[model samples]
Target: MKRILIILVLVLICTQIKAQRPMDWAFKLNLKDYNVKYSLPKGFSHLDSMISSYCRSDWSELFQYSLINTEGDIAIRFLMIPITPKTAEQLEYRKRLFNLSELFPPNQNYLRTIYFQLEADTTNRIAYYPKAYAKKTFNVDVAGEYDRECKIVYKGKFYKSKVVFLHKEDRMDCFIHYFYEEGKEEKVRETIAKTRGMFRLR
Candidate 1:
């Protein structure tokens, strides 16, 4: 019985070790892993502030951008910006999605914001995450939920995602959205796990 228990413990440890993705990065290879020490790009504070204030939720601990390196001569940057709008006017201004079925034309990512509807005061509020998802097509991969309301997208070989939490408690009554990488089903599961823990639908 002692030997059997010991073997079981060993198996558990081995499984846990394999489950965690390694902390790794390479020169000009930003997607190797996630690094959060860096400050966000300029021109993003107002948007971030608006999101936090509108939702009345703290977003400093929310998902940050993961830099990815590329072989292309032109500069390519990639990161997920989570955001929400406080007012209807603000929400309308953030609609930045344009179609990119063509790549040879070299489409730059539309720096867009996905809004979440929530109840605040007598007025309804929309919140958003602020970060741009930009990158070269070959270097990174992106998948998003483009619907009537919520839009979610993640980029690159490593698993990094952006999401908006929608609940049926009060004001809004429509879309619920979550985004992830196209082929990265495993990573998407991990993202959902983290999402459920840190976010609230209501």
Candidate 2:
């Protein structure tokens, strides 16, 4: 009887410990336009506070949130831009700038160099959400998705990174960028999918 009682107490203690552990993901930030929640992979940390300070110094208008892992190999950024007619026109113009063929005219060398510097791949395309979700959540016809493996020069070191872009245009435009170490591309993609799956728009 004493042995059984001890076993039950151990089981109860284990269950309580597990319940008290933090979730893999949680609500992280609240902004004027929307709220954001995020999760980092096993060895990562959220860097919103540090990144926010740098963003406010220069990109305060568009910067929303940012995250980075402890190893400094992965990062994510969220930006929200209000959609006015003028801004919509500018967005369209910037989209065209991604066309390599159209980039052959004025300052071709500079433009092409900048393009290759980012190593933008040819995978840009329209990303469609579920009809119900599009209508209800973002009210957008479609989102723009692009991903690539690129090289980033940071602090005098070159890092090969996989970058993913998710842009949604509605009453406001939402952009998300996910950057991870190149060799972990598949894992990063899975993480992004899971994050989006649980993403909240309030």
Candidate 3:
């Protein structure tokens, strides 16, 4: 009976140790393609209609549309450029130059090197880091991260283009991402396939 009690206590200690460890994230390709599956989070409302209605969804319009999964701390947004084809019909999001500095004050040295604007599929990835909280930066780089753009080729006229982002943390390479285009299905498929196993996510 004494020996059995000791064995049970040892087993309990091992279980507690395993549970206390942080969960590690290694990027695995469970979902191979970026389909139209990720639209709205459950228990969330579509405010795109309101955004387009009250505040003209154009270049001049100062609004950024985004969706966040409360279950998981991931969010993606697009820069809505009113209903104009010229504004709406874009692959490269060059127009966003006007607003990069808007999110953070111009005086601070910010980074935008890892951004692209082909039909403007802008993505903002937020991942948590347990270590860096006590330091100056708190679980994030490129502070106040947000994006605004439109789905350029939803109709039959455009070639689909996709873009990716890597969060700048040495511990984990996780990134929040998005993509949209019209005719370049093969091109998009190839791009998605390549991203698999390349980056690790937290």
Q: What are the TM-scores, per candidate, against the unseen true structure?
A: 0.23, 0.46, 0.21
CA lDDT, candidate 2, residue 22: 28
Q: Write the per-residue lDDT of candidate 3 for residues 1-202, one digit (tens) a residue.
A: 9999999999999986554332211001221221112324343332221232111123232223433333222223333111123422231244374443333112111222223231233244422233343123323332222232334322233222233333332221122333334444464445444433322322
lDDT tens digits by residue: candidate 1, 99-167:
434221111111122322222221223333222221121111222232221122222232223333222
Write down the lDDT of every candidate, Cα atoms only. 0.28, 0.45, 0.31
Better of 1 and 2 by lDDT: 2
- Give the lDDT ranking, best first: 2, 3, 1
User: 2 or 3: which has the higher TM-score?
Assistant: 2
Worst 10-residue lDDT window, candidate 3: 22-31
Who wins the lDDT comparison?
2
**On TM-score, who's better, 1 or 2?**
2
Q: In model 2, where is the ten-residue run with the lowest total lDDT?
A: 51-60
Clash number for every model?
A: 15, 1, 15
RMSD of 2: 12.1
User: Which window of ten consecutive residues has the lowest lDDT sum in model 1?
Assistant: 46-55
Candidate RMSDs in Å, in order, are 19.2, 12.1, 20.1
